[model samples]
Target: MDDILKLVEEYIKEKDSKKTWVAGEDWVQYAGPYFTHEEYVRAVKTLLNGWLVLGAEANKFETKFPPLLGKELGLFVNSGSSANLLMLLALTSKRGRNLPKGTKVITPVAGFPTTINPIFQIGFEPVFVDIELDTLNLDLDAVEKACQEHPDAKVITFAHVLGNPPNMDRLMEIVKKYDLILLEDCCDALGSTYDGKKLGSFGEMASCSFYPAHHITTGEGGFVAVKDEQTERIVRSFREWGRGCYCIGKQNLLEKGSCGTRFNCWIPSLPDHVFDHKYVYEEIGYNMKPIELQASLGLVQMEKLEEIGLKRRENYRSLFKAFSKYPEFFHLHTAQPKSDPDWFAFPVTIKDGAPFKRSDICQFFESKMIQTRPYFAGNIMLQPAYEGLHDKDEVISKFPIAHKVTTDTFFLGTSPVINKEKTDYIEYILDCFVAAIRI
Candidate 1:
């Protein structure tokens, strides 16, 4: 078996020797595929070991991840969206201090749907708010107005859109004043900082993604970080099929059962004590855990997060400088004061009356084999998924800012893999766009 594995590794290494750049590429991509041979080898070894489920490696990641973000507990899940689901479900658990039912959760309309979907799924009302164009994040003024209009709001769920941290100081003040829970969606802003603190650490709870496009790539994994013991317990319970037991994975070796007797358990007379802890259920939950293979990849990815963040920031700066010269054709998004963005993507908005439409420019990039993506779910409320989910008249016309961003905005890649060659090609394409607009 070892010899066979060695041969497979050798073949992979030989294949990787040939770097294939797509031809006729006039511009770069919105995200680059990031991976190293060593990481893949680690994943394969984990797979071969037969411990494919969450175990020691997952536990190590959970332990190390929170400290890096200045948090207490970290729970890994299958994806960032799953992490959000786990956090929301945990907040609603019967064994936990459930947030008020029908509680309104304030959120920006221009973000990923999972951020808001979990609220609705848990029977909480989501109050859509507008975002600031400068940071592409929830506008503090809009959030304040929403709170004023809906004093029943008990939670404020927002994202650091495109890696630009929101006005955390102002947002936290509102959270405290209104006695609201804050859940920061840091999936896109893993390494971002505001006022010297990490983006995900400021909120009561935070969520992060480890997809390839994010600052770090774990293929398909994510985590939720919580500040307090109670929240951590709740998070773990929800992630572990809502089990009441607080013990770690397969480590509850204590012979003294719940009733102080090895054979006598206390829950409605069960053969004097033959109860299996595996069958226990404390809260309504679902299976949302990731495999050990994913966690193995995450361990390797975490080691490079700092380097990846630096490259993303550098790429963002270069893109901004290149586009700053064409203010008439492009409006560049800016970071908030006291923010050092770990930008996920550099957003660009087409000014009103621009000679060409956004679709036209995007197609040009596509023709050149350059990839692009619209700002996440762009005005999520406007999407078909929300047609029957929300009150059309009340929300459809209210989020003007979100509407503007959804229509006029698009973002480019700042992935660490992008280099000078890619950036120069992108600039050249933009020059063509400028010339075409004048014609």
Candidate 2:
């Protein structure tokens, strides 16, 4: 087994060595996973261990992940979408100070569906607010206005767009003034910080993605991290099928149990003095737990978090410099002075009177095999699925910026996979395309 494992590791390394980032006709992916040979080996080892469910690897990843984002606890889930759902559901748990049904949640109009879907899924009214064109984040001024109009709003949930931190100073003020529960979707802003503190750490709870296109890859995985023990327990309950059991893995330990109630816990509704904790259902939840294999891969990917962040920042800067020369034709994504963003992609918005449209440039890029994608579901409210989900009165502010985003904004590859050759190709294509438009 040892010899075979060594050979497998060597094979992975050889395969990795053959990969390169030279510019060519092949597709330049908008996003791709960065995995070292070690990650492959760890995955194989976990597979051999046969603990396929959310076991030791999941526990270790959950335990070690919180500190990276300056949080107290982590709950692994199948995807970032599930993490978002779990986080929202936890806040509505019967065990916690549940926000009453139909409570208003303040969210941005321009964002991915999952960010706001969970609010509606969990029976909360979503009050949409506009985004700032420059930062591609919630315009806090608009957010404050919406909050004032809807004084009953009880929660604020939003994403750090393309890993660019929002105006944390003003956002925190609004959060405090309204006394709202804050949940940051840190899926894109994994390593981003506002005022020197991590974005995820600022919110009461946060969600992170481990998808291939995100900062890290576990094939398909994510986590919901919290700052308090009780919240952690609630999140854990939701991720693990709403079980009352707080045991790490199972309730088979000889000593007191993981939660100190292994064999001793009374149920008010039950006739039994001490029912098994594993079977206790505390709240309505779902089976969203991730497997050990995904956790094993995530553990290895976690080791490169800082390195990936640095590379992403480097790529973003180079892309920014390249695009800055075309300010008249583009609206480049911006970061506040207090923000330290590890950008996920280099977003470009065609100016209102630009000779070309987003489709024009994106089509040209696609023809050259340089991938581009629209901002994820720009103006999610405009999406067909939302036809009847919201009331007309729920929109307190106009989504002019969001409407512009849907038509003007698109993003290019700034992933670590983009090397100098690819960047040069990108710049060359942009120059040619712009010159053509000028003609």
Find the candidate with the highest TM-score and give its number: 2
In candidate 1, position 341 carries an lDDT of 87
* Candidate 2: regions farther than 4 A off: 20-22, 390-397
Candidate 2 least-lDDT 10 residues: 389-398
lDDT of 2 by residue, 186-271 (tens): 99888888888987998889999988999988999888989878888888778777887787765445476676765655578665
lDDT of 1 by residue, 20-117 (tens): 55435434667755777767777788888888778777878888888656587888888889888777776776666577679788988888889888
lDDT of each: 0.80, 0.85
| Error at 350, model 2, angstroms | 0.5
Cα displacement (Å) at residue 44, model 2? 0.3
TM-score, cand. 2: 0.96
